[model samples]
Target chain A: MKKSNIKSKHIINHPLFLPLVCLLLVLIVNLIQTPSFFKITIQNGVLYGFIIDIINRSSGLIIMAVGMTLVVASSGGTDISVGAVSALAGAVCVAVLGTGESYRMPYIISLLLPLIAGMVCGAFNGFLVSYMRVQPMVATLILFTAGRGIAQLITGSFILYVKPVQFQYLGSFLPNVPIPTPCFVATFVILITWLTLKYTSLNMFIQSVGINPKASHLVGLNSKMITFFTYVFCSVCAAGAGLISVSRTASIDANNVGLNVELDAILAVAIGGNSLSGGKFSLFGSVIGAITIQALTTTLYAMHVSADQLPLYKAIVVIIIVALQSPEPKRWYYMIKSGISSGRSAREAN
Target chain B: MRIFKKTAAVILAIMMFMSLAGCGNNKAPVSNDSSDTGTDEKSKSIYVGFVQVGAESDWRMANTKSMQETFTEAKGYKFEMVDAQQKTDKQITAIRDFIQKDVDYIVLAPNTEAGWDTVLGEAKAAGIPVIIVDRMIQTNDNSLFTAWVGSNFKQEGYDAVTALENVLKSKGIPDTQEINIVTLQGTMGSSAQIGRTDGFAEKMAAHKNWKMLDKQSGDFTQEKGQEVMESFLKSYPDIDVVISENDNMSFGAVKAIKAAGKTCGPKGDITIVSFDAVHAAFEAMIAGDIDVDVECNPLHGPRVEKLIKALEAGESVDKIAYVDEDVFYAKDAASIIGKRAY
Candidate 1:
C-alpha cells in the first residue's frame, strides 16, 4: 500500500500528469457516451474508427504544438501568425503547382519552395522579435494579418485545386497502406526534433536562454540566435501542417486554409503544462495536449452538441482543464486525500 | 390627367426598354455609341460604383466576376469596383466615395446587415440609387436602398430537401423507410447557415419517416467539414444522408468518408446533398463523390442589370429580387461542369 501510494504521488508530480489526465478524461467521456469509442476496425487495409480518427486528425495539430512549445519556451510569447503562415505556405505550393493550364512544376519543387518561403517569413518575424527588440506579439502580428493576404494574391483570390492523386497522398493514406501519411510526417518531425535536442546541448541552451537571456549570454549562449531559430523552426512546422491541409482538400482557400488553428496550437502548449512566459518545457506534454483537444472536439461531435452551443462547451471544458492544471485545485484534491489517509493511519496507530 | 400621363409615360418607357432588350442581349445600352457622340459626349458610359464584400470564397468571387463581366467598357458601363475586404467601414467609405463622385449608380455587397442603415440612409439622402447584392441589409426603412437582390438562403434549404427526396426515390428507398439525416452547416448565424438549417428542418417535418439526427457547423470550410463528419459517422452508424451547407464542406465530407474507408455518393452508403453548385461541386458530382448540389447561383450581375434597366425605365421593381437557382445531380455534372461560368 505504501509503495502504491508513493507511485501514485510520483505520477501526480510528473509534468505530463494533468495533461494526460485531461486527455484520458476526455476519452473516458466518449467511452461512457458511446461504448464503441475505443473500437478500431480494418477496412480496405486502412484503419477505421473513432480513436483512429482522433489520431489522424490530430497529426497537423500535434506537429504544430511541438513547434509552438519551443517558440513559447524561448520567446515567452505565442506565434499567432502560424495559421496565416500555414495558409500562405499552402498558397505558395498550390500557386507554384498552378491551378490552371500553367505547366506543373516538379512536385518536389512545390514542396521545398514553401519551406524556403516559410523560412523567409520566419526570418522576418525573428528579426523583428529578437534583433529589433519589438514585442513578440506585435512582431508576429504583422505576418499574422498579411500572410493570408499574400496567399490570396498568389492564388488570385481563388481556391486553387491540385488534382493529382499523388498530391493527395500526404493528407490522406498511402497506396495500399492503412495508416495516414501525415502520421508518418509528424512522427518524422518529432523524431528529428527529439534527436537533435538529445544529441546536442541545444535543448539546455534554449532553456537557459529562455530562463534568462542576459544571464545565458554571459554564459556564452547566443540568446538572440536561439530565439530566432525557435521562431524559424515554428514557422517551418506550420508550413508542414499547411501541406497536410492543402493535401487533404486537394485545394487551397487562403481565407480558410488555417483559419483559427493558431489558437488551438497555443492552447495545446498551455495545456501541456508549459508557461507562456519563457521557461523549461516538455515537448511530449504538448503532443498529448494537441491530441487531447482533438479528442474533445471529436467527443463533442459524437455527443450531438448543438452547433451553436459547441464553442461554449469547448470553452467550458478548456477552462476546467486549465484550472485543474493550476495549483489551487490540486492542493484541495491532495488535502482531501491526505485528510482521509491520515484518519485511517491514526486509527491503525490507536 | 397628370397621373394618367405619368403612367402612360412609364408604360411607354417599359415598352421601349423591352424592345431594346429583345433586339440584343445587353440591357439598357446607354445612348447608341455612334449617335451618342453627337449629343452627350461627356457621359459615355453609365458610371456604376460597386462596393464589393471581398473575394473571400469562390462563390463571392464568382459573384464579383459576374458583375465585372456584365459592367464593361464595351457594355457601356464605366465600372469602378472597390473591394471592402469584408469590412463594414470600408464598404461605407466606398459608398461615401461613390456619393462624392456623384456616380450614376451605387452597388453594395454589405458585410453586415446591421451598421448599413446610416450609410445607406446617406446614399438615400444623396438620391444615389443603391443596389444591394449577395447579402441583405437591415434597416427600419426599406427605402434606404433601391433594391435588395441575392439568393433566398431558405429556398436553398427547401431545395435540398426536394433534391434529397428525389435522390432517395431514385435509389429505390420507400417513403415508409426510416431515413436518418445529419447536417453539416456553414458558419453559424450567417444567413446561409440559419436559412439552410431552418428551411431544411421545416421541410424535414413533412416526412414522417425522416429523422434529423444532428446538426453541426463546419464553418463552411473543408477541414472542419471533414472533422465534423468523422465524428458524426462514429456517433451514428446508420446516418442515411448528409446535408452539407456548401460545396467546400461537401468536399471535406467526401474526403473524410473515403478516408474512413466508407463510400458516399449516388450509389454509395451515404448520399450527400450540398449547396453552392460551384464548378468544383460539379466536378465532384462527375467524380461520383457528391449526389446532388443545390445551386446558390452567384450570377447576379445580369439580374442586377435587369433591375437597373427597369429602374432606369422608371418602372417600379420588386424590393426583394431572388435570382433563379437550380439543382444539379451527379448524372448531369459531366455536361454541366464545362458550362459553369465560375
Candidate 2:
C-alpha cells in the first residue's frame, strides 16, 4: 500500500507527466483517425512529415515560453509585449543586414545587434516594473503599444527581405541536414536554462520573490534584482524567437511579424500546469505545453477544419484542457478515487 | 531608492527624446518636399488635406508614393497629409484637424468602416467636400462624402474564380472533371476576407465538380501562410489548385509547396491563383510560379485626383467611381509587368 501511494504521488507530482499525457492523448486521437499521422519520411537527408512540422513550428513558442515561465514565476505578472518586442528585434536584425544591393554590416554583427536590442527593450521593461515600482502589466503595456510602431519605424514601414543563404539557414534546414535549425536552437536554449536553474539559486530566489517580496527581502535576498533579471532573460528569449521567425520567412513585416504571439507564450505556460499567480514553475512543462498547442493546430488542419471556424475549435479544446488542469477538477478526481477505495475496503471488512 | 529613481528618470528622458525625434522626422519630409517645388508655386495652390491609413504593407507604401508624387505644389496643389498609423480614432482626429484648417478638399482613407458618421457629418457641415479613398465608411447619410474611389472587393473575388475557370479550360480539363481547391484566406472578419471568401464561394458553388478541400485563414502574413499551407499539404496531398487571397500568402504557399517536394506553378503539377497584382505577383507570374493574378489595383491616387479635379471645376462627379483593372496570365505577364506601377 505504501509503495502504490508513493508511485501514484510520483506520477501526480511529475512536472512533465500531465502535459505528456495530454500530448499522447492528442496523438492517439490523430493515430486512430489517420494512421499515417505518426509517419515521418526522410526527404533530402532531412525529416519530412506532420510530426516534424509541429516540432519545427513550436520551436519559437517553446523558446518564448521558457523565458516567460521565468518572468511569471518571479513577478507573478505576465509580459504582454513579447510579440511586439520580437517584431522590433527582427526589424533591427534585418535593417542591420541591409538589402542585398547594399550590405551594410556583416551577418554576425547583424544577428547580435537584434539580440542586443531585445536586451535593451527588456531592460527598459525591467526598469519600469522593478525600479519605478510600476505594475508589471501596466509597465509592459507601454511596450506592447509602441513596440510594433518602433519596429515599423526601423524598417521604414516596409518589409525587409533578406536574400543571403547564410541568414536562411537559421530558419530553414541547412544543406544535407534533415532537421530545421530552430529545433536545435530551441533545444540549446531549453538545456541552458534548465542547467542554469538547476545549478544556481536563481530559481529559488525568483520563486521566493514571487511568493512574497517583503519576506524575501527580510530574508536578505535581493528580490528586486531577481525580478529585474528575469524580465531581461525573458526579452532575450523573445529575441531569439524573433531571429528564428525572420530567418524562416527571409523577410520582416513589422506589423505582422510576431503578432499576437504573446498569447501563445502565456497559454503554453498555463497549459504546462504552472500557476499564473507565481510560485513553483517548470520549464519542461512549458516546453511540452508549447508542443501540445502546436500539435493541436496541426491536428485541426489535418482534419480539414475550415479557416473561419479554426479559432472556435481551438477555444473549445483549450477550455477542456484548462478545466482539467484546474484545482477544482483535481480535488473532485481525488475525492471520487478515495470514495471508491473506502467503499471497497468497507465491503472487505464486512 | 535613489539609484532606482535615477535610472528610471534617465530611461523616461530617453523615451521622451525618441518620441520627439520621431515627430521631427515625419514633419521634415513634408516641409522639404513643398519647399523644393518653389515658394512662387504655392500662391495659387489648392490646399488639400489627405489623411491616409498608415504604411502597413508594400501596397500601401506604393499608394502613398503615388499620391505624394501627383499632389504637389508644382501641380497646383498644396498637399498636407497625415499618417493615421492604422488607428480609426487617429484618422477621425486628423480629419477634424483638417476641417479646422479649412482646406479646400479633405481626402480620407478610413481605417475601419464604422464610427465615422459624426466626424464626416462635421466635414459636410463645414462645406469641405470629402473624397473617400481605398476603403468605404459606414454612414447612413448619403451626402456624408462627395465621392468614393476604390475597388469592388467582391468583384475581385469573382474575377479570380473566372480567371481560374479560363485557365482550366485552356489546360483541356473538362468542366465535368472533379477539381479540388484549397484557399488561404486573409484576416478573418475584415472586409477583404469576407468579400473575397463569399464571392469565391458563390462562384465555386455553381460548378458541380469544384470541391473545396479546405480553407484556412493565413491572416494575410507570409509566415502564417506558409504554416497553414504546410498543414494543408499533409492533409490534401492531391490538391490541384491553391487560391491564395493575396500575393504575400501566395509567395508563402510556393515556399511550402517546394519544401513538401511538390511542384507548384502554371506548368507544374499544381496551379496557384493569387489576388493583388502587385509587382511581386507579376514577377511570380512571369516566373511561372503563379498561374493567374487578379488585379486589386492599389493605385487609387490618380483616380481620386481626377474626381477632385472635376469637383473643383464646379462640375458634378459620380457618387462612386470604380477603378478599372485587368487579370494577368503567365503568357501576358512579361509584357504587362513593366508598366505596372503597383
| Candidate 2 structure quality by residue, lDDT tens digits, B57-122 | 778877788788878767778887888767788889988987877778898888988899999999
What is the two-chain DockQ of model 2?
Answer: 0.56
Candidate No. with top DockQ: 2
Say which docking band candidate 1 falls in.
Answer: acceptable
Candidate 2 lDDT over A262-335, as tens digits, reads: 99999999999999988889889899999999999998888777877889989998888888788897799789
Q: Candidate 1 — which residues are off by over 4 angstroms?
A: A1-4, A100-103, A337-350, B1-47, B71-78
Model 1 agreement with the true structure over B60-110: per-residue lDDT tens digits:
878888888888778777677887767789788888977877777998888
Q: Which lDDT tens digits does candidate 1 get at residues A1-350?
A: 88998998999999999999999999989877888888998866888888888888899999899989999999899898999989999999998898654438988988999987787677777767887778989988977887876787677778888877788899988898889889999899999999999999999988888899999989888898899899989999999999998988888989898888999999999999888898899998899999999999888887888989999999999999999998898899989998998999999999
Candidate 1 TM-score, true structure as reference: 0.90
Candidate 2, superposed: residue stretches over 4 Å from native:
A101-104, B1-20, B27-47, B69-79, B97-104, B169-177, B309-317
Model 1, backbone clash pairs (residues 3+ apart or across chains), number: 0
The stretch of ten residues in a row with the least summed lDDT in candidate 1 chain A is A95-104
